[model samples]
Target chain A: MEKHRSAPTLDDVAKMADVSTATVSRCLNSPDRVVEATRKRVLTAIETLGYTPNFAARVMAVKRSFTIGAIIPTMENAIFARGLQSFQEELHQRGYTLLVSSSAYKPEIEEEQIRTLIARGADGLLLIGHDRDPKIYDFLSQRKIPALVAWSYLPDSKLPSIGFDNRAAMFDLASHVIGLGHTQIGVISGLVDGNDRARLRVQGIRDAVSSSGLEAGNLTLVETSYEIENGAKAFRDLMNADPPPTAILCGNDVLAAGALRQAQEMGLDVPGHVSITGFDDIELARIVSPALTTVHVPHREMGRKAALQLVEMVENQTAGTGEQLSTRIVNRPSLGKPALG
Target chain B: MEKHRSAPTLDDVAKMADVSTATVSRCLNSPDRVVEATRKRVLTAIETLGYTPNFAARVMAVKRSFTIGAIIPTMENAIFARGLQSFQEELHQRGYTLLVSSSAYKPEIEEEQIRTLIARGADGLLLIGHDRDPKIYDFLSQRKIPALVAWSYLPDSKLPSIGFDNRAAMFDLASHVIGLGHTQIGVISGLVDGNDRARLRVQGIRDAVSSSGLEAGNLTLVETSYEIENGAKAFRDLMNADPPPTAILCGNDVLAAGALRQAQEMGLDVPGHVSITGFDDIELARIVSPALTTVHVPHREMGRKAALQLVEMVENQTAGTGEQLSTRIVNRPSLGKPALG
Candidate 1:
């Protein structure tokens, strides 16, 4: 609220220091151009008066800030760590400082954070997904701001997205499960409410199942938040059904891990009693016992590309068209032939 | 370099708009305060000239930005996630935005980021660990900036630290392992270079062994980076010795999980063949097969405290001393009594 108050101007400092407004401006912007005596007098006047410069006025004058803002859904997992690390490295190489804020998977929070980043003079922005209120897009367009969406690619969307094809990728992984003769499949998906990637991935699996002449309702689905504990609990609830699924397909590795851990605790033999699979081959996938069978997302590649694209859009005023990366299923011990009736 | 050179200023916009400097500043900072007719003139001039405000100059003038910057060692793992999430949530409750950056365990990078945050006019800062160049302390002090350190508590440190006692906490866990009658111990530690917490933890284990009348030299120590794969490799090397120790102590859960996984791969029974223990009872500790015995660090609690303390310092203009938090060993299946000779 105090920051919103009218800031002291160069004219005020000049009047208090008994100097011309031009001298005050030179002292603040380029002290080397002004004599030390005048600069000292100006600074003393500034300190005594508690003067603060108006950022909006200054940004209107300066065309650059060397600041990049990135908005991620959540930071509680290592899912985006590798890619974000590479993105930050590239930004550092270009002498740009990165400012990151998490949205906790809330659309309203993401919108607020976007406005805050813009207000803070971020030259460019890296968004997680292509799903949000279109008004945000309009705001960015009206401001002529550069933004690149990562995590999921949306070719038909108006914004340029730098990510993998969530639908096609998940479809490929699901087809693989179907190829393995997994007819009685169960899915543990992330809550799809504002998450386009999660929703698309779930639809991809459904498309694969329906194309195979399987009744869509036969595939039991459990939607939950993204956490290992939540995944485990969801798995337990899904497993307690009247006729439990013979194969489980999780939205991501985090959930698959929970399912696997729960299965172990429940004394069920993995891949024998029921096969399990996951998306996003994070570190936990390999570390978990009976290493998870999941899709290997190119997080680092996406991160690097997103940074470059956003920076290009910011610097060259070039509009971006969404680019799709690749994803593949990594066969591990978690998935196997289900037991015969 | 281009960003540094092509920065816009208030003077450029005023000259283009054909208005006094006061008018341009008023138009941008408070358009409602200015007449609508003159505001449109300034807006058109801004668009034609492609102007952006200078953040640094504004920060120097406003003294309040409602932005808090946090610098952590790394984001490669979930060690800092839970706590940071809580910290960010608390700040959000009070209508402040959190800007986070990672230093990758580099002191120079941390120092640069601290200066950058200050120059960007962060209202406060959350830093990890108390070790740093004293000149950074002098800089923050001269600028009257508020900062709080987390992860490890130093009672006599000049800066305010909100964390647990690393040495004493590890000492307690080590004593628990000693009580389990494991005299032959192998230690897997994080690289102590520039890491006071890791060094103190290792020392704490050594002290525990010595106090138990066991030869400290018998405690084989292997230092590695904080990665699961690295932990596995270190475990193998430690186990390959002619007489492997009966128990293995890891600096953190990541390393402990690695040791456990490697033990499983080697067909060595955990607890029966070799007992293993880890610090930082992260989710991985529980997720790993045969839940790990580790020190239960209150990460969320520390995060909340760090945020509150930093904000307090920022508002009150007084740095507080270390406030110690408690830690205890979580007894899990990873550790067991030593096998009989």
Candidate 2:
């Protein structure tokens, strides 16, 4: 308590370590810029003095918080966890702190969080998708707060993004499933009202069906929230239809896992009775029995690139460009040819 | 843009909504306190005027941000996701927003994040585990910041916690395994250097071994970071021992998943060639084939209770008490009697 009453400053640390205050600042922000010996001496002095940099005062002077905010759709699953972890690692390497919030797939909640983050002085933001009200874009531009969208990419979008084309990736997988001679198809889709990624994925399946000369209107579709139980329920609904679909494609791996579990409970052999596939090839894809055939997304790369680009925009005040990543199909055991009639 | 030339104030909102300024404030903070019709009128007026509540000014006026911060060990897995989601939900219901940061299981990073969150004006903190430095507790107390620990419970602790007893729970599971007539056992544990939960879990196994009149030192043990790949590597190491144990017990479900994957890769039949068990019966436990025999923790209950208690501490300025939740062993196909030699 007595020690904090007279808080040590950068000057005190410099004097104690016999270095300039600039060097001390460098050590704190970018240790690699300073000599190792000098860095160690400054750090030792800092520990001995119990000095904590006054972050609020720093923000006041530099007009930068060195903080980034990310508002994800949900935190209940591992869908965004892997990418967010990589994004945070890159942010930390560049001496930035990350604060995250989950909106539970509600646009109103997301807008509120965005405003909250901006009010809290975040220099930049990492948003998930590009399916928000244009008024939000206007507000962000008005405030000059740099924000980047991730997870779904658009080639000619007004907003910059660092992700793959959801539609194309899903289309490729759907075409492959159709090539296996499965005329009847079912889709377990995420609710698409406010989520462009889910909407695009479902459209991709439709595109493939129409191109393959199948009656697109004959497709079985069940839209629900992104929970495992919801996925199982949707799968049952699709299967109960007259002339049930031979192949089922899920919006993501979590839903596919649920569908697979329900199939097991119903005493059906995967890829024998019906084929199953999923998107967003998360770790759960391989962990489950009859590993899911899915699309492999470069989640870590997208995260790293988003961090670098968002930081660049914040520092340089530039309008960044979109970079589209590629996705590929992973032909695992979950998807196979339908049984002969 | 023209509207931004003059910002809307509380008086403007009151006049437009035909209510007192206090009513407008109540509508924003505690909608339940206002009549439904009045609240709807205020909300409509707010939307029409594009009036965003001045969060910064409110913070300065009340000396409270109404934002709760949570720091978890890692975000790369689902270990903390379920509980944290519940915590955030409860906070939202109480008109508070949650900001989360991941420490990557590093003590120094956790310390830095703790300071960052406090500096950002969090009204309270929700910390995972109770194994940080004593100086941190001193700092929080000096600042009058209310912090509650979750995920591991301890009685008579200076700090309050809401979680299950890790040591006792693991002890019960180990005793169950030993009772199945397994003379030899292998343990795969998370690193225990600075983590009280991991240390207590390992100690639990030791207690079970000693109580059963077995040679505790003869038990094969491998310690590593909490990752599925690391778990697989540790399992292989344990199996390479001169006399491989019939059953392997993993510290957590993620590690157990890795061990199970490695077993499949080695063409070893689960519960036929080797029995495997895991702690933390998360969703993965059920998703994996030959479901894990593990301990079931009431994660949602713990999260909800922690949020309630932490908010009480912050609002009323009272010292909180530790409340322990109970865990039970889940019997599944992964555990069975050892095969005769």
Give the runs in model 1 whose Cα sits over 4 Å from its true position.
A1-62, B1-63
Q: What local distance difference test score does each model get?
A: 0.82, 0.87
Docking class of 1: acceptable
Interface RMSD of each: 4.3, 2.0
Tens digits of per-residue lDDT, candidate 1, B15-81, equal 7778876777555543556788787888788667756444443344344566789998888888888
Query: Using Cα atoms with residue i matched to residue i, what is each candidate's TM-score against the true structure?
Result: 0.84, 0.94
Largest DockQ belongs to which candidate? 2
Across A21-108, the per-residue lDDT of candidate 1 in tens digits comes to: 6676555444567788888999899767655443443344345656788889888988788789889877776656688899999897
- Candidate 2: which pairs clash? none
Q: What DockQ does each candidate score versus the true complex, computed on alpha carbons?
A: 0.30, 0.60
Name the best candidate (by TM-score). Answer: 2
Sum up the clashes in candidate 1.
16
lDDT of 1 at B306: 81
